[model samples]
Target: MSAPDPKTPDDDPLVTQARLRRERHERWLREGDMSIGRRLAQIGVLGWIFVAPTLAGLFIGRWLDARHGTGIFWSAPLMLLGLCLGGWSAWKWMNSR
Candidate 1:
């Protein structure tokens, strides 16, 4: 009788699971886990990514309001726009990782 091919979809599920696990283990051994400090640094970067643009928007809006004497009209919308932009940027950055 001919032996079953391991590469075939009909191969044993347990054997497939074991092979996947072994591959994952080998990959983990090659690339170590993320350190606590590295994780914290990533968090900080994300925070800045979200905050910097928002703050810049607020300041610029305020400046424009001061120039035109609009009294919060420009400031409010600009700040909201900044918030949306920052949020979108942060979301994209997170997804890329």
Candidate 2:
């Protein structure tokens, strides 16, 4: 293999400055990607807020079933409905934002 040539005037200060600025601009474009963890946390908070009441109702119904053992099943559909509605709301909110 041949030895490489020494640096030339093509490597002048103005050229170097332009190259540095281009690199910085590209770096910013790469780093501007959204954080998946942050998005997931926002969705989780949405789900929690929307689903809390249904889950609480489920729990209370289950507790009441300590006497009858039937109210618990009655709450299952509510839980599922809550999950669907909450997920829809979360997706809508995220997409809107």
Candidate 3:
């Protein structure tokens, strides 16, 4: 007769989720709640992350349009591209935290 394989309890999804939740709760208790100032700072940083790339794209697009005399053609597309880049960057930053 073949011996039965041993199953690891930690491999279960529910067990993993409970473990994560407990760790997070412990960390929160250890660190205390986030201050209002800290939250505001985080918000500011997120805004800057989303805005900087967009403004850069707009400025560059404007310069290109002016140099090539293409009216608003380049500016519009570049601005949209910049907005997308900024949004993606902000999303990634949020997820990392």
lDDT of 2 by residue, 1-97 (tens): 9999877766788888888789878987988866899888886788686787568756665666766777567577666776676667767776665
**Highest lDDT among the candidates is held by which one?**
3
Model 2: worst 10 consecutive residues (lDDT sum): 57-66
Query: Best by TM-score, which number?
Result: 3
Each model's lDDT: 0.90, 0.73, 0.94
Which 10-residue window of candidate 1 scores lowest in summed lDDT? Answer: 3-12
Q: Which clashing pairs does model 2 show?
A: none
Q: Rank the candidates by lDDT, best first.
A: 3, 1, 2
Q: For model 1, how does the per-residue alpha-carbon lDDT over 1-97 read when each residue is reduced to its tens digit?
A: 9987557654879878889889888988998788999999999999998998888899999999999999998888888898999999999999876
**Candidate 3's residue-wise lDDT over 1-97, tens digit each?**
9988776897788999999889989999999999999999999999999999899989999999999999999899989999999999999999887
What would the TM-score be for candidate 2 when compared with the true structure? 0.41
Task: Report lDDT (Cα) of residue 86, candidate 3.
Answer: 96
Which stretches in model 3 have alpha-carbon errors above 4 Å? Answer: 1-12
Model 3: lDDT of residue 39: 100
